[model samples]
Target: MELLHKFSFRLLPPVTFNFNHTRLASLYLSTRFPVSGPAFSDPGPLFTSRRPLSSSVVSKAGWFLGLGERKKTSLPEIVKAGDPVLHEPAKEVDPGEIGSERIQNIIADMVRVMRMAPGVGLAAPQIGIPLQIIVLEDTTEYISYAPKEEIKAQDRRPFDLLLF
Candidate 1:
């Protein structure tokens, strides 16, 4: 009889970014040792190792900029399993109320709390409101391997609103 143990390895997808010729040239020039005379003058075959090197440079830049990083904590919303808010329809936001400074402040505070709790998503009811507004930060996909700086630079955008 043979004994076996389960094992798995997660592979990260390659990071890619759009860069034009001039930008690539600039990056290559900046990172490589300064050379006198016109640089890249006798440009060797276009198939030189330049492409891979440039890719690595850009990958490092992306990592530094937190382009695809994830947050550190796994703070899911705290709604209890039997909370009624889960089943109840969310309230609609009045158009006039949407742009008020108070509403904006609330949104800001919500973002702060979310960050502190390290939660990915939060509903108004969870925070004691019945409004349809929701703020979420989805960093699950990038959390495991993304650098800290990259995770901090992550951005969030809202989608369509759900109304009761």
Candidate 2:
């Protein structure tokens, strides 16, 4: 329809995908497994060690806090494990719909999820919306506990909610 024509899908490869064939689409995607964190160093010819995740490079803040604890709340489900949509670019939001009830609700839900996850930001594709909307907030939780030197190096102080 009109929406489909308006939004173009950046087909990853094999330029002949038949979207109408749900079975083929699912089968193709099913073969691929998602790896979240950084790549593992090869332990041997046929083995890879996943223990050395590069979180250590994240800085003193990540080492101290350990990627904020998730507390249950009215948060939307975060699409995890690097789904295909995560790699797909989001569409632009229609200007006229910016202040509509649906858009406002989506924004509220996204903000709630970000705070609950204790994450710095959340993008629309993160939640599988596929629209160019992002919500961010700096709670300053890390800055509070970071050493003076670390604080001097990077200042991520609390900031007001941001919507885009």
The candidate scoring highest on TM-score is 2
Q: Residue-wise lDDT of candidate 1 within 117-148, one digit each (tens)? A: 76665667676555687786655542645676
Collision pairs in model 1 = 66-150
lDDT scores in order: 0.61, 0.76
TM-score of each: 0.35, 0.50
TM-score for model 1?
0.35
lDDT per residue (tens digit) for residues 1-164 in model 2: 86655444432233565677887879789866546523433334444567654554554364556444546455568998779888888899999999999999899989888877768899988887899999988766845766878777775467888998
- In candidate 2, position 162 carries an lDDT of 91
TM-score, candidate 2, is 0.50
Q: In model 1, what is the error at residue 89, expressed in angstroms?
A: 0.9
Count clashes in each candidate, considering only residues at least 3 apart in sequence or on different chains: 1, 0
Q: Candidate 2: minimum summed lDDT over ten consecutive residues — where? A: 6-15
